[model samples]
Target chain A: MKRALRLRPKGLEKGRPETKPTNDAERRQLMTAEGEVRGELRRLRARLPQVTGALAASADGLVLASETDEAKEAEHVAALTAAALGVALRLTEATGQGGFRELLIRGESGYVATYAAGPTAVLTLLAEPRINVGRLHLEARRSGARIGELIRGALERPALVPRKPNRPPSLAGP
Target chain B: MANTETALKEATTAIEGAVGAALVDYTSGMALGTIGGGKDLDLNVAAAGNTDVVRAKVRTMELLGMQDEIEDILITLGTQYHLIRLLKGRNHSGLFLYLALDKQRANLAMARHQLKRIEADLEV
Candidate 1:
């Protein structure tokens, strides 16, 4: 994480010495912002023993931070969440329910709950079937809101630093 | 819900491995009377999601130019079978019945048969 963050500034600092230090500082800030989001996920897991995994993903299906066992599973889950969200949004609109806030899907063995983390991100949780759903919603909703704020804060903080336009066709894990 | 609530109830209790059932307005993505969702799902919300499932397939079939009436749409997940039966007749127009089942214990063919029976016996 640090290497990539540091490398961006060096690559851009061929002649632009005026903005180099501040950009480096901004990258450091971004890394810490990501760390804070991870910390929130960790704390959420501590609170809910039934929570097997937690992931934050952009609305467009990019993995922001994954607390799952496998990186590939996290990426797949994030992408699937984006696809599912599209349908859920349409369903809500068709029913005149306004925007979607959350979606909870339960398979035969377990549960996959997704909370809308603001407008641009989603927080997904994998939990055991036996978990208390009311409590899961109570806790996940709070964490989802916090992660949203933290992420949005990071994005806004680097206001001058325009986001890289070259997003990968597939996920480039953050 | 008033007339066929019993029918929806029977789907869960009578059908082996039945998880849930709902009568949906696929046109509006609204659930009529949802019951017995697998694990902890809100059957109403799942029903709405399934509306898109039905729509997407119908649209795909149209794209492929397969001109046939849809009878049943089956979605097989790792551990569950989602059986959707599109209702015929005038009163049941633009509607579909959704049945979710546990894959392990479910007799898929029998479930389909029983669901067809429920559909035939459906009042509204």
Candidate 2:
């Protein structure tokens, strides 16, 4: 945000509270971005009744906004989502399956699905056991992308640019 | 598709000079299935020990910000070859196939070739 706002002079370091959007207009803008993301989650629920709950978090797993009944558990869910993400990213890379786009995990009781909202955010959905997975994916992917945009807007971050995939420099590095 | 039991059996029985083989879940360091290890080889111990090797490599990749995944790792000793092949695809994430062979009698190239073939058919 500090970078995006250009409030601080060049070479100014971190830890300045003034860098935050403290002005009323700036704060409203940030809230609106957050509101839009949460709204998208709700709209997704209405479209796909199978989606019981959903939350959008940063890639590091900090919850930006959520629309889930299990409010108290949201923290743990985001943390675990991040952990699962680490494994999923590695799993995809290891398989030469390209970059991770989404992940689906089905338990006997229900499904825990996650999608890449953007380069820096993730969308995780909790669904009932009887949910239509295909429909869920269809709806969630769009919502994930929308939420990613809102998040990037709120944070004033630039869009993700695909980078050239680089192979490991050497296997003997360790 | 190959099940754990049959896969272990095949790797041990078919891979020339293979003393032991195990389908290891590296996340838990548990040998889900094992075959052909006696007191000298200790497939269970090898499975757990090799988990460290896999983990170290994974961490190194992260630190280096590498965009590639490991296909397999080979370690050579005076009289043995330790092969650890990471399972690919969605279903078998966090799992690896471990095989121990008598280096003197085992053909490293052929061993890798056979491992790749078996890995393709392995379902778990």
Candidate 3:
């Protein structure tokens, strides 16, 4: 029973790479996976020069993958982004707005935009002034839908921890 | 707003000295659109500046651990009233439509009701 409630399976193997694709096959697989889902962020980048980075993160703020050096800080960004997402989600529910779609952040140097990627993940982008923001937004929205499909696929997998059978009660115990 | 154009136009005309009427997103400080911003009042600057107001208010609510949502935020100037209404619809989260009206000509009750109507129709 304790095992069933645990978040992840206990460790038995350790040789696998911690992150990212390491070879051509894996890279090709990832690209194909995204492409299959119609995740075409590359085209968006071509149209928007200021959109320097794009990434997808889990609802818990775990960085899935990103195009920038900020991958190392993805967790932190994800967490804060999740907080904002939570607020946005709730606001939509409370107001009868239909559904929460996206979030936007603007600063002097750049803009950070996030969109809902299915139920369990988010797609985020960092854009500067050089790009056509409107075009970037259009592309990002399409990519967000594809990312949502990817996330949904990941979420459909069985839980890592297995459940245990119920134990019979002991007569002697008080 | 379900009838943003009508409400905005009415607000501007009815109020004796309304400088502007705008629907702004507090999170990004972007005006979805605006009406009545004159040379003296820049709606863009107002939108950006008001982001700080929304942020500070939200931060304060967090510090106090308040679970209630902000219904409306009123900023009172000597001659002006800056009214911020947080949208309730799922379509417009992290956004509040703001209206600036002159203190003398505007009726607060009518303004609030009209603003609510406008919020209902805003496309976001």
Candidate 4:
């Protein structure tokens, strides 16, 4: 019999924290951009008949937005995407295949696909088995590019504040 | 129902010119079971490496807005054919079967047919 091993790599759940905006203006701008991203995801789902779920996550596995009803499943899928992305990036680099593009996995019942939305985020979709592959790619690519821009723009905003360092207690004199 | 290991071994024996076969979890990039790999072809490494291929294709499909199920992924080389068959069924999600065959002795069509049968019978 084939051995089934359940393995979870170290630090797989350690997603990078989003940058904190320095002031109210920056925070408002970031919020607006995030709202736009969510709207785009919703439209993508609405336009695609076979798409059962859609999620946007950071490269480190943090879930930013999800259209699925199952929040837990979305979280798990995001983490898995991050892990798979690591391997995909390395494979492309080692084989001189240029940059990572996308990934698709098909099963008897449905399909799961991951797209590199931008330099820092990934977009994943779940769809039915009978969905049209060509259409899925066409719409997803356009939406992914748009999402990438929104996310990258938010990340590049100059109003982010550096995290404060912890201070040790003074022991020299009381 | 046949187990994954039995199914893997059966695949190697039933398919002509098969050098190695493995059951891999693309989510974790780990091989659940393997048979018939040596110095020239390491089943573990192949299984892990192929996870990336499966992932890349899935990503491409999403980006292109193509909604379709992948039946199998075939990679052809000078002397070898790498076949990746994604598993279906509720219990078999997130898994795939990887088969490597010597191009000279294997019939691609027949091999794919046999692998499909094995995949159907495989019990996760």
lDDT of 3 by residue, A40-110 (tens): 45555665556787767655555566665565665567778767766776676578664557788878888
DockQ of all predictions against the true structure, Cα-based = 0.02, 0.02, 0.04, 0.03
Which CAPRI quality tier does the interface of model 3 achieve?
A: incorrect
Of the pair 2 and 4, which is ahead by TM-score?
4
Clashing pairs for model 1 are: none
lDDT of each: 0.75, 0.74, 0.63, 0.77
Give the alpha carbon lDDT tens digit for every residue of B34-64 in model 4. Answer: 9998999988778767877887898899999
lDDT assessment of candidate 3: 0.63
The 10-residue segment with the lowest total lDDT in model 4 chain A: A165-174
Give the poorly placed runs of model 4, Cα more than 4 Å off.
A1-32, A158-174, B1-124
Position A29, candidate 4: lDDT: 39
Deviation from native of the Cα of residue B98 in model 1, angstroms: 34
On lDDT, the candidate that comes out on top is 4
In order of listing, the candidates' clash counts read: 0, 0, 11, 29
lDDT for position B104 in model 1: 99
Query: lDDT of candidate 4 vs native?
Result: 0.77
Candidate 4 TM-score to native: 0.45
Best first by TM-score, ranked: 1, 4, 2, 3
Please identify which of the two predictions, 1 or 2, would achieve the higher lDDT against the true structure. Answer: 1
The residue-level lDDT of candidate 4 at B95 comes to 88
lDDT of 1 by residue, A1-174 (tens): 011001122255466441122234444444456678889989999987879999987666767788899999999999899888767766766786765678999888789999877655779999997565655777788898888788657755644545553221211122
Question: How high is the lDDT of residue A159 in model 3?
Answer: 34
Between 3 and 4, whose DockQ is larger? 3
